[model samples]
Target chain A: MALLEIKNLHVCVGDKEILKGLTLTIEQGTVHAIMGPNGSGKSTLSNVIAGNPVYEVTEGEILFKGKNLLALKTDERANEGVFLGFQYPIEIPGVSYATFLKQALSCKRKYLGETPLDPVQFIKRLKIRAQALGVSDDMLKRSVNVGFSGGEKKRLETLQMAFLEPDFCILDEMDSGLDVDALRVVGQGVGIMREKCRSFMLITHYQRLLDYIEPDIVHIMINGKIVASGDKLLALRVEEKGYACYK
Target chain B: MAQKEIENIIDASYKYGFETDVETETAPKGLSEEVIRFISTEKKEPKWLLDFRLKAYNHWLSLKEPQWAKIKYPPIDYQSLYYYTVPKKKKNLKSLDEVDPEILKTYEKLGIPLQEQKALAGVVAVDAVFDSVSVATTYQKHLAEKGIIFCSMSEAVQNHPELIKKYLGSVVPYTDNFFACLNSAVFSDGSFVFIPKSVKCPMELSSYFRINARHSGQFERTLIIAEEGSYVSYLEGCTAPQRDENQLHAAVVEIVVLKNAEVKYSTVQNWYPGDKNGVGGIYNFVTKRGLCHDYAKLSWTQVETGSAITWKYPSCVLLGDHSVGEFYSVALTNNYQQADTGTKMLHLGKNTRSTIVSKGISAGYSNQTYRGLVKMSKNALNGRNFSRCDSLLIGNKCGAHTIPVLINENKTAQVEHEATTSRISEEQLFYCEQRGVNPEDAVSLIVNGFCKEVMQQLPMEFAIEAGKLIGISLEGSIG
Candidate 1:
């Protein structure tokens, strides 16, 4: 069974339609990349899957692990092992990164009918995962993403994905605004998280991210629909052809 | 915001609205010279005190209730309120055990145990004032050993008359405002603390005020004096029982910090905030101020989450050279509640400094406002003041306002003010939710973070409780 299945999804932001008749599926153990131009609905697809209320799913069916994902709230989808790496991470002024992650992890544990991690164990696991993502201990102590540079914010997002260990991860523009060194670090972080039980969907406008973590399948999205589908060669082709043919 | 979501936020009921079933004595329902005389006689106050009350009574009679605050309410019927009431058993109680069991249970229900054994250990000394009098004061003996005079205001009148006479109404004169004059005339009981020169208080001193008598107005007076080179930290918590009629609570708090002394005052006010339609609740109008002498410091931290209509400004006066003043506050108004609160920082001495941090959260149909004033006198060379006020609106129906006044009379004085009003963004909420936190908890986390600066100023023990109060006040604010 597919880890994530979207059938004829239609999403609208206010009166304007952003995602029109979009359909895709990702099986377990596969990393699928979606390449699209600006306003091509790549970010909208990730946001709709995360159940953001602003983007109304006018008509759609989202199935995750054979369950109706659209009927669930954002947090419920998260508890079911679905993650959306935000394109723009928010700056919550007073909430420390450590505190936020602990509460998030506790919520997931409660949903899974498992005992919550004690403070000692929680801190231990957080430090270990954050270190792997090259996140400084000082960053965790600071307000969540407040005053973080572009690279620091992306690294924090990857660190969160690593900590949650979600079964299906959606990286939305995760490679944007990152320097080459930072991009390599974030890519390697994602590369290390790949497992047989997990699936990933990388959404981006460029194919440079694919050079670090190669994709099993790449799809081209244009004008709110997937126009083409192929393997890794599709991303390379777009990088060279500049999406003029798809237009 | 959906109608259902707004309804849920409005239905977040008050948890500390249970009445104590205790027999009580109450004064006649009226305000007059006779009422003031009656109260003075009942407490066996000195002639000077009675004279002071009479002067304030005449002054109060000539003044009208101020209507300048950004809050609306039907005119308060001062004549219809019982000016004084006390539990009958309080006159004969010799110890905590001898006090009324129902009263003890009431405090326990409010998460404050009155019994010495079950109380919040030695870290805090509490003076629990119920209705019109202090019922039980814990850790008094321990505090007394440190030369820290902590007791009921009525007791201070009898035991430390000199100190009370010298500092009472000194910071906030009796004729400062209409409500302050009323409180001076009929004030019943509140905590009084005095730290002698060079003495550092060993534990946090606290006063818990509970308004229990029906139709009874609670007028409490608190006075704290930190002598030269002394230091103290004080906390105050207040709650009232639910009733169908609005209750009047007018209080006056004054603190004096002498040369090189320091004092920290914190208040967590969780009074009943009325019903969904704003039928009944407390009209909390208070005057709290402090004066800092040479090289002294004074800080005020308050978390206000209750009262149907609140009009209070806890202020500081930097009167001495190199003195410092700070005000940190988090005021939340939900349902039909209204709050107009902030602080005043006056720099009169050279090189004096002050800081103000105010955060307001408005939910449901409530309105929250931050009104502040920062003034630096001409002689205040190199004086500095920084003020920041932030407002967070939960639902679309509520309102948040910031009104700040800055007066810099000296060229060398530096004053900076920043204010921002924002709603909890959908993206921020979704980000938290997508991390597995529920919506309610997500709101709490973001709000707590928003008010972190003020919360950090609170003492460790009170900080925990204040955080919980913030969460409770914002319950159901999000759909």
Candidate 2:
């Protein structure tokens, strides 16, 4: 069974249709890369799947692990092992990164019917994961995303994906604002998370991110629909062609 | 979620609205010289105190309620209200056991057990005031060993008459304002603390006020005096029962920080706010002021999340050279509640400094305002003040206003003010929700973060309570 299945999804934001008709499916233990130009409904699909209230799902059904995903709220979708790495991570003043992640982890644990991690125990795991993702202790102490550079925000997103250990991860332009060195760190940090046999969807405009994390299938989205789906070579193909023919 | 669903959640969410039923004594349903005499005579006050009350009452009769605040409510009928009420008791209790079981249970239910055995030592010494009288004060013996007088206002009048006569109404005189004058005339019972010279209070001194009587007004007066080179941290919390009719709570708090003394005052006023339509709640009109001597410091941190109508301005008078005054507040109003609260800093000493950080969160059609004043006298050379007022609105209809008045007579003084009003960032809330925190909890976290500066000013234990109180006050504000 597919890990996530979206059938004929139509979404809108304030009567302006963003996703006209979109359909996609991701199986377990798979990496899917979505390549799309700006204003091609790629973000709408991700937001609709993540249960963003601003995006109204006019029609269609989303099935995650054979259950109706549309019936759940944003937090519930997240607790069901779904993660949406924001394109431009929001800054929350006065809320430290460590505190935010702790609450997130506790919510997931409670949803799984498991006991919350003791603070000492939780800190131990946090330090290990944070170290692996190259997130400094200083960043963890600072307010979430406030005053952080682009590379820093992306690194934090990678760190969160590591800590959450989501089953299905969606990286929405995760490689947009990263330097080469930082991109390597973020890509590899995210690449290693998928080594545990989890599924992921990487949305990027370039094929550079594919060098760090290989994709099993790459989908090209245009005009609110998936235009084509192929193996890794298609990403290289789109890179050379510049998406002019896809229109 | 539908709009009606959100309204349902907000209207039905008042966890601390339960009323405690106990036999009580109440004065006549009117205000006059007789009521003042009745309150003073019932407590067995001396002639001087009665004369003071009569003078304040005469002054109060000539004055009218001020209308400068940015709040609206029906005219309060003072004549139709109970002037004073207390839990009926046979005699003064020597021990906690002698206290009424029902009253003891009421405090216990309110998360304050008056019994000494229930709480570990070195945490807090509480003087519990119910309605209009002090029920019991714990850790008095332990506090008394250090030459500290931690007792109720009534007890202070009896045991330490000199301190009561010397400091009572000294910082805030009876004619200061309408509410303060009313409180001076008819104030029943509140906490009184006198820390001796050069002694640091061993434990936190706290007062818990509960208004269990219906249709009765609670006018309690608190006075604290920190002697030279002394230090003390005082905390007070108040809550009232849910009633369809608005109850008046006009209180006056005065603190005198002597030369080289330091005092920290914190209040978490969680009076029962009326329902979504503003049907019933407490009218919390309080006047709190402190006087700082040479090299002394005074800080006022209040977490006000309750009360249907709040009109308060806790202020400080920087009197001596190099004195410091700080005001940190987080006033939250929701569901038709209205709050107009802030602080004032009067710099009279050379190089005196003051800081004000106010965070106001308004939701559910409520309105709030942050009104402040900073005045530096001509003699206050190089005085300084920094104030920041931030307001966060949750829904579309709620509003937040900031009004700051700063006056500097000294050319060397520096004053800085910054104000910002914005809706609770949807991006922040969505980020939290995307990370598995529900909308309600997300709102709470974001709001707490918004008020983090002021909340961090609170003491450790009180900070946690204030955080939770903010969460509860914003319940059902979002779906």
Candidate 3:
């Protein structure tokens, strides 16, 4: 069985189907990249997986570590070690980043039947994770993405992903707004967390991210379905030759 | 979710409503001259007080309950309510130890630990009033040492008659309204605080009013007088028992801040919110008014979250030049509660300034309204006023309204008023839940955020309880 399996998933936004019979599978200890042009339903797939209420799954089976994933609520899926790095992270005013992250982390720990870290222990672990992602103490004190710059928000998302330490992560354009330096820091964080029990699905349009965090398999998605699959060089080919080759 | 239900054990309707089974001192069940005499004679009050009560009672009998407020309720049977029920144990009064544990437990249940704290340690003296009498008062000597008279209104009538004679009915005349008139006649007990001239009140003064009787009405009359160049902050909290028969609570509060003096009054009202079906809630019609006499200032901050029906408008009269007035309020109504409360700022002083920030939250078939008035006189040249009223509706069946009456006469005055009514969007709550916060916690977080602008103005202790009260009041408001 695949570590994360998507079998004939069909998702609809309102009355129109967005994800049409899409299927994919990734084994543990591997990274898979899904590259697509605009209007390819990449963001929709990430949100549907994260349990966005707007998207209705008409038909699908998403299995995460042998458990049915589509039946869980968004928070349940999160506590079950499924993380989604949003393309546009929400700006929640008056809610401090530290408070939000602590609650989320404690919730996940509680779901695992593990003891929640005391404030002191939690803060100590938070500083370590935050430092690994190049997050400043000031960022933790500020409201969640309230006035963050574009690069800072993407870095925050990366910091959240690192702090969560999920079994699998679907980065939805996580590298979109990052500068070269920020993207490198995020890539280094991801590389440091890469292990045999962890898997990642990188969704991006550019090949620059693929260069830093190389994927074992690169799939080309078009009009809601994966049409092409290849190794790392396929991303380079698409980067230089454009998506017209896959189309 | 089951854990949530268990944790909500304390979130049950205001539980301090235990009516003492013993009855000794009681007045006739009606607002009559005989009842006023009965209360005055029971307390051994002087003839002057009996005359005062009789005069006010006569005026009350001639007037009718005002109908201008947006609140509509079943006619209150004034004749059926036992207006006065003082505890018979006051005959053995001594120290805090002599106080009844049941009365102290009432405060403890209300989250006010009043017994052990050194009375003089804090600046605010608390007068705990239960049912129809003052249960206990703290920091009497300390307040007296500073020439600040702090006691129950009945005690003040006997001990500090000169101050009462000078300031009573001055700010809020007995003829002001029906509630005020009735309170003037048969008001059982409330706090009376007086700060002498040029003295800064060392502590906050507070009165906790608990309605323990079922059919008996609570008519408290609080009067705070800040002499020239003095300053004081007073707080009041009210709670009632759960009952199926509607209870009437008509209170009158008056404050007089003299020249160059400042007074701040804050209230966190959590009366019994009738059952989900709106069966037995309190009808709260209160009259609170302040007068800024020649450069004095008065500010009112309130967090109102209970009552089946609330009709109040704490107002200020700025008569002094350069005087200031402010009103910050957050009123939440859920599960059949109806609240029509706000403030009235009348600027007669030159260069006077006023700000009104009112927030209304309505859910579960409840209705809330922010009705405020800003009246600027012709002499209010260079005066400035800013008013913002925002309403948040939780369920589709609830409603929120903002009615701002702005009367601007001076062209030089700058008056800006803004109002917005919005529903608690699914996006906001979902954003919180996505962070692993449960639905109830998410709703509370958003509601707290919305009311932070007003809650921040509350005192440290009050701010914490007010936040918790908001969370508790919203227990079953959301699914």
Candidate 4:
């Protein structure tokens, strides 16, 4: 069975319907990218799948691990190994970045019925991982995403994905505001996680991020439905000819 | 002139003339001349103190309860409430079964033994009380070496009448306002601290350390004096939850910081709020103010989370050159609670500076208001004040208001005020929950973040656990 299965998913914000009858499936250890123009309900799919309260699922059956996924709360979905790397990650001042990631990881550990990590061991691991991702000790000590540059915010998001190790990774516009160097680092950071039997759902408009982390299949979503599905070549074709051809 | 007249008129024989005193545990329910006299007599207070009470009571008769705050409550029947109760309440403590179940429940929660709980609760008149003698003596002797006088108001009156007479009501006079006037007339319990010149108190004098410590109860009057070049930090209220039966609480706190002295007063008040429906809970009306001399600094840091209705303004009169005054507060209200709290900074000295940081959090059906005043007097050349007041609303039903009054009389003085009212955004909440934190923990995480500045002003342990206290205050507030 697939890790995540969305069938006839219809979502709405207020009285306006955003996602109209979207259906998709992702199996274990496979990477899939959803590419489309703006207003195509790309972000809505990620939010509804992550159980965001703002986006109401009018009709859908989202199954994770062969169980009803929509039945769980947002945190429950997180604890069950589903992670959403937001396009514009929220900035929460006065909460240390280190504390934020540690608490999130602890919650996942607790949900998995695992013992908490020792402070010394966790600090050592955090330092190593942070150094690899170019996150400074000062950044770790500072408030989470409060004053981070756009590149730094994406790096922190990648660092969080590294620690959380969700089974299904959804990166919504992960390459939106990245410099060339930051883009390479962030792309590689997500690329490294693709080896852990983790299914990836990369929602992007361009094929730039695909150069670093290749995807098995690419789905062109137009007006909330998968209009076309093909290999990585499809993303390159959309990037060159523009999304107008798909319409 | 009245003080001197009262002293001269208080005949020596009148002290012994008062009938040996009734054997009753409480005065009859009412406020009158007889009740004031009865309270003075029961406490064995000095004639001048009694006269002061009488003077305050006489003035109170002409004052009415202020209705300017943003809160609604039933009119209080002052005449129907008891003005005096024995410090050592005569509780029928034959067995634990006779105690209020709430008391026992709190005892169990605090892990206190039945006997110690009874003693702490002032239910019994135990002679061989909890052996705080050794502990108290240790700190008292240490403090005495530095010429520090730290004791209860009653003890201060007995041991150092001259000091009390000179400084009591000096900062906040008896006729300051309605509630302070009432507290002045019938205050039964409070703390008094006198830090001598050039001496620094070694410990954080907390009411929790005393074995015979009595809660300020409904009416508390406190006085603190920091002499020249001295330093001290005093902590009020207990960290643990307290079940107070009093529905109306009015307190007055006054502080005088002399030349080159600094004093930091921190209070963490957690009285037992009524049930979620707000059937019955304390109405905290407190007036706290400080006077700062040249180069003196006084800071009031308070974390108020209890009480159905809280009306308090801890202020400072910066009278000395280069003096500093700071107010850091975090007032959290939940479950039908209402709070109107802030601070006043009167910059009267040259080059004096004041900082005010207030964070108000409202959850459930609660409402909160941050009312502040920053006044720069005519002589306050180069005086500066910076105030940042922020309010966070948890649910849609709760409300938060910010009212700041800035009166600048001096052309050279500058006052800057900034305020922002924000509800916990769905994006912020969803971000936390998506990271695997539950709704309650998410709210607490966001709230603790919002109140970080004020919490940092608290003592180390209190600051560390402030997040948990805020969490507990907003329990059952979110889904």
Candidate 5:
């Protein structure tokens, strides 16, 4: 069974339709990349799947692990092992990164019927994961993503993904603001988390990110629909030919 | 988000709204010279104190209610309120166990168990004032052993008359403001603390005030004096039963800090905020100020989350050279409540400094405002002040406002003021929700972050309580 299945999804922000009849599916142990131009409904797809309240799911269905994902709220979808790496990470002024992650982890543990991690073990795990993502101790002490540079924000996102260890990860333009060195760190973080039971969907406008973390399948999205699908070559083709032909 | 869902999220009933049934005695309903005399005579106050009350009464009759605050309320009928009330007791209890079980239960329901064994464990000395009388005081003996005077205002008047007489209206004169004058005229029981020179207080001193008598106005006066080179931290908490008729609560708090002394005052006010339609609640108008002497420091931290209409400004008079003043506050108004609160920093001494941080959260149909003033005199050479007021709105119907007044009399003084009004961003909430935190907890996290600086200033126990109060106050405010 597919890890995530979207069937003829139609989404809108206000009265303006952003995702018109979009459909996609990701099976377990797969890395699927979606390449699209600006306003091509790529971000909208990720948001709808994440159950963002701002984007109304006007029609169709979203299924995760053979369950009706549309019937749940954002946090429920998250508890079901679905993750959306934000394009622009928010800066919460007073909530420390450690506190936010602890809360999120505790919620997931409660949902899984597992005992919550004690503070000592929690901090131990946090330090190891933060170190792997190249996130400094000072960064963890600061408020979540507050005053973080573009690279640091992306790294923090990677750290969160590593911490949550979601079954289905959605990387929405995760490579947008990262420098080459920082991009390598984020890519390595994602690579370390790949497992036979987990899957990922990488949404991007360029093929450079694919060179770091290879994709099993790549789809081209244009004007609110998937126009083409191929393997890694499709991303390379878009990088060379641009999105003009797809439009 | 469904309108019904938003209503459900915001319709959390007041948790501390249950009234305890007990026998009580109340003064005649109305304010007059007779009522002032009645209050003084009931407490058996000294002749000098009665004269002070009479003088304040005459002055109060001459002053009108100030209309400068950005709040709307029906005209207060001062003539209709019972000025004083007290629980009927056979005699004064020598210990906590002999106190009225009903009053003890009331405090327990409010999460403040007054049991000797269960008391905050010597870490805090509490003076619990129920209605208009001090019921039971804990850790008094321990505090007294350290040469610190911590007791109810009435007790201080009887036992420590000299100290009370010296500092009673010294920091905030009886003529300070309308509410202060009214409090002076008919004030009942409140906490009083005095730290001797060079003595750092052994533990945090606390006062928990409750208004229980129907139709009675709670007028409590608190005075704290820190002698030269001493230090003390004080905590105050208040709650009242839910009632349909608005009750009046006018309180006056004054603090005097002498040379090389430091005092920290914190208040968590969670009075009943009335029903969703705004039919009944407390009209809380208070005057709290502190005076700092040479090289002294004073800090005020308050978390206000209750009352139908709140109008108060905890201020500081930096009167001595190199003195410092700080005000950190987080005021939340939900349902149909309204709050107009902030602080005043008067920099009169050379090289004095002050810092103010105010955070206001408004939800439902409530309105919250931050009105503050920072003034530096011409002789305050190199005086400095920095103030930041931030407001967070939860719903479309709610409102938040920031009004700051800055007066720099000398070119050498530097003042920086910044104010911002914002709604909890959709992206921020979504980010948290997507991380498996529900919207309610998400809102709490973001709001706590918004009030991080102020919360840090609070003691550990009070910080935890304040954070929970912030969460409960904002319940159901988001979708």
Candidate 6:
């Protein structure tokens, strides 16, 4: 069975329908890239899968590991080993990154009936991950995402995902506004966390991000539906030519 | 004086209704020269102290309760409340263990475990006062070893009479205001702290005041003096049981930071607020002021999350060159609570500086205001100050206001003031809920984020407690 499967999903925000009849499935140990132009319901799909309350899944069934994924709350989904690297991370002042990350990690542990990491052990783990990601000590000490550069924020998100060691990862345009060097860092971080039991869905408009992190399959999404699917070369074709061909 | 006839005013129920009647020593219920004399005589106060109280009593009769604040309540019957009450049945306990069970239970109900455990280990001493008298004070001898005099105000007059005659009424004079005047006259008991020169207080000195029973007012006086090059941080918390008839609680606090010394005073006021209809609650009219003498500094940080009606303005006077002043506050009002509180910074010394940050949260039918002033004297060359006041309204029925006054007479002085009012946006809440957080948790996270700036100013131990308090108080604020 696939790690996450969606069958002919229909989603709406408020009274307006956004995602129409979208079907996709991803097995473990693979990276799937969803490339689409703006207003093509790419972000809507990402948000809906994350259980964003603003988006109503009018008609669809999302199954994760044989369980109904639609029944889970946002945090519940997070606790169930699902991680969404947000495109625009929320800036929560007064909540330090260290403090928030610790809570998120322990929240998952508590759900798994495991003992939470003590502060000393947690900080020791955090320092190694943060150092590897080039996240400065000052940045980790500050309020989460408050005054963080775009590149720093993306790297921080990836660092959190690495710490969480989720079974499935969703990158919602995580490469936007990132320079080539920062993209390499983020791509490498995601590459390190990809194991046999893990899967990923990279949602982006441009195919450039796919160049750094090669995907097993590339799907072209348009008008709330994936119109075409192919292999690695398909990403290059779309990068050279645009989504116009798929349209 | 006897309990006056109950007036048929707005009848409301108090929410924090609990009381303890112990074998306490109390003067007659009234405010008169004879009452002051009786208190002075009971405490064995010096002739000068007695004369001071008499003069303050005469001045208090000449003044009226200021009506400038936005709080509304019935008039206070000063004659019907006991001005002095002390536990005559005590054998002078050494710690909280030897204290009476009823008094200990009162503190415990208020969540103040006066134990020597790590949770409350940092607390240096406590002046646990009930109604109009102090019941117990801990760790006086340890503080005394360092030449630090920490005791009740009345006890200070009896022990350190010279210090009382000099500094008493110097920072907050007898005629400072109506409440201060009244407090000076019939002020029965309060904490008196004196830190000698170049000494850092070993631990935090705290005072917990509880108002039990109805129809009785609580008038306590607090005076803190940090001598030259000394430092101290003091905390004060107050609460009262619920009642249907409005009760009066008028207090006066004064701090003097001598040259090269610094004093930080923090208050977590959770006085009993009347029910939703705003019936019976404590009329919290208080006057707190501090003076930063030459080359000294003073800071007032408060988290006022309770009170049916709160009227206070803790101010600072920068009279010494290069002296500094700061005020950080987070005032949350729910139900029918009305709070009109802020601070004042007066700059007289050259190169003096001041900073003010006020965060007000209003829910239910409450009203919260931030009224402050920053004044720079003509002789204060190169004076600087920055003030920011922000208010967050939780519901449509609440109101938030900011009234700031900045006066600069010196040409080189710099003054900046900013204020903003924001309501809980539907978009923010939806964003959190989309993340699967419940409505209440989402609201609390956002509110905590909003007040992050002020919360950062608190000490490490207090910051955690303050954050939890904000979260708990904001529960049910969102619909």
Clashes within 3 Å, all models in order: 0, 0, 3, 0, 2, 6
lDDT by residue for model 3 over B277-359, one digit each (tens)? 88888889899999998888899999998888999999999988899999999999887789999999999989999999998
Report every candidate's CA lDDT: 0.90, 0.90, 0.83, 0.78, 0.90, 0.81
Error of 2 at A84 (Å): 0.4
Docking quality band of candidate 1, CAPRI definitions: medium
Error of 1 at B460 (Å): 1.0
Superposed on the true interface residues, model 5 gives a C-alpha RMSD in angstroms of: 1.5
**lDDT by residue for model 3 (A5-114), tens:** 99999998889988899999999988889999998998888877777777889997999888898888777787787788778777765567887888777777777789
Candidate 1: what lDDT?
0.90
Deviation in Å, model 1, residue B286 alpha carbon: 0.3
C-alpha lDDT (0 to 100) for residue B418 of candidate 4: 92
Q: By summed lDDT, which 10 consecutive residues of candidate 5 chain A come out lowest? A: A108-117
DockQ-based CAPRI category assigned to the predicted complex of candidate 5: medium
Q: TM-score for each prediction?
A: 0.97, 0.98, 0.91, 0.88, 0.97, 0.89
True interface contacts reproduced, per candidate: 0.84, 0.75, 0.27, 0.75, 0.86, 0.30
Worst 10 residues of 1 chain A by lDDT: A181-190
Residue A65, candidate 1: how far off, in angstroms? 1.0
Clash-forming residue pairs, model 3: B123-B203, B123-B204, B124-B204
Q: Residue B198 of candidate 6: its Cα lDDT? A: 97
Off by more than 4 A, model 2: B1-12
The candidate maximizing DockQ is: 5
Local accuracy of candidate 2 as per-residue lDDT tens digits, B331-363 = 999999999999999999999999999999988
| Two-chain complex of model 3, DockQ on C-alpha atoms against the true structure | 0.37
Per-residue lDDT of B287-329 in model 4, one digit per residue for the tens? 9999999999999999988777899999999999999999999
